[model samples]
Target: MSDVGALGDPALEDALTGLARRRTVLVASDLDGALAEFTRDPADTVPAPGAMLALRGLARLPGTSVAVVSGRDAATLAELTGVRPGDPVALVGSHGAESSVAGVTAQRLDDGQRALLDELTTTVAELIERHRGARLERKRAAVAVHTRGLSDDAEQAALEEAVGLGEGRDDVRVLRGKSVVELSVSHADKGSALLALARVVGAESVFYSGDDVTDEDAFRVLPAADGHVTVKVGDGGTAAEHRVPSVGALVVVVRRLLALRSDLAPGAR
Candidate 1:
């Protein structure tokens, strides 16, 4: 195993080792920018090298749970991550609004909620049409305006227009991420999703990593007293207790966790 100390933060390293020793632990992470590199086209994103293998390996360890919590829909996340049904790693998609867990589904939107989504979609679509480099991403329960290719002024204008549409709409929730603005009928956030997964799996501690503004929700929800590891993957303001420099560094973190768990397993050298 590589030196745990070299993983960057000593406290984070110690916390991860402690989690490895726990009887029940949850390792959850965001996909875009966390496990996968961010791309102009979200569909083009894939997991960093060895990331999926590490997650699957960690999940196979006794008493450990792994989950991918993402903003993409569950099916898309599964397809992109190559997660088949019955895989050890769980999937939470649409920023926690959807999941692959049995008997768990996103709450159905009421008629009014549906109308709000329609309005949001139409409004964002119009803005996208006006902006030369903007694009619209339609999800099962949400719609997003992507400004990755837009000029600074156009991106700001698109964001402002999108935000205006949701003004005082209690049923609608707006979320801002890296060069994107999303409106969702469901109010689920990564924090709620992570908490729910932890409760279902009876996790004594959870280690979550993310690299977007939305990831702060998960970071805030992790139990601080349990020494849960919250890692931010890139440069940004974050609530995560620890920060890794890039997706490459995140891969190392996962490998380090795997090594620590391997050492703690029975019959280890």
Candidate 2:
């Protein structure tokens, strides 16, 4: 089978093959589109088929680190992934604001941004409550307006309203996510977060996977230029080093590693 999805490109394959040989792999995957299906709320979200095994597989890899980075908070990722003993993986939640290793105390939002919560909630309530199926999500350091309602008109209007909220803050990115509009106060994105972790681990290479416009930012920056592989889940104009048809394929890649590690584990006897 010709690898036709993300990581199918020869350049990306060569990079991953090379990475497997020398670097301490850092597989930072986005939670939603990249792993789990983009859902309207946390209560309804489900982890992708191989997500748990993938984390376990990375944990077993020598000097390899895997993180489930998402817009969800730290507690949420840990709970959803069904984390067990000896898991070296990190959960970069709330868009890198709530990291299990960094601790919540380290998470910060600008004073001005923090103080705007009241206004944001009121406005968010006003904007989404009026539309059928519209949902509101208040993340740790960011706010989201989920329009999975799939109404193009509603989505367009919601984007404008989201941008309006940051009218004075040009530094803020009014990123359009898959079916949601997000407002984040922290400058750290999935990419920066990945790079920071890789640098801390003295990484020689990086393999980053994501499935949204936000993931695109991280795709632009990879550790040690040549040894990095980028995988984009689903279709988009992402500059990722590779592109996978869907999260399922992403899970397939993850499963491969998991199976590899499982075979190496001590026998059941």
**Segments in model 1 whose C-alpha atoms lie over 4 Å from true places:** 1-6, 103-105, 265-269
Alpha carbon lDDT of each predicted model: 0.84, 0.69
What TM-score fits each model?
0.92, 0.85
Q: Write the per-residue lDDT of candidate 1 for residues 91-110, one digit (tens) a residue.
A: 99998888877544566668
After the best TM-score superposition of candidate 1, give how far the Cα of residue 130 lies from its true spot, in angstroms. Answer: 0.6
Lowest summed lDDT window (length 10), candidate 2: 260-269
> Highest lDDT, which number?
1
What is candidate 2's lDDT per residue for 1-269, written digit by digit as tens?
12346435565455555666653666778888778887656557888876777776676677677778787777767777775445687777776666665422345776787877556767878887666667787766667788775578977777677768766776555667777777776666776777777776666677777888888778888633667777778876867766778888888766654454344422311
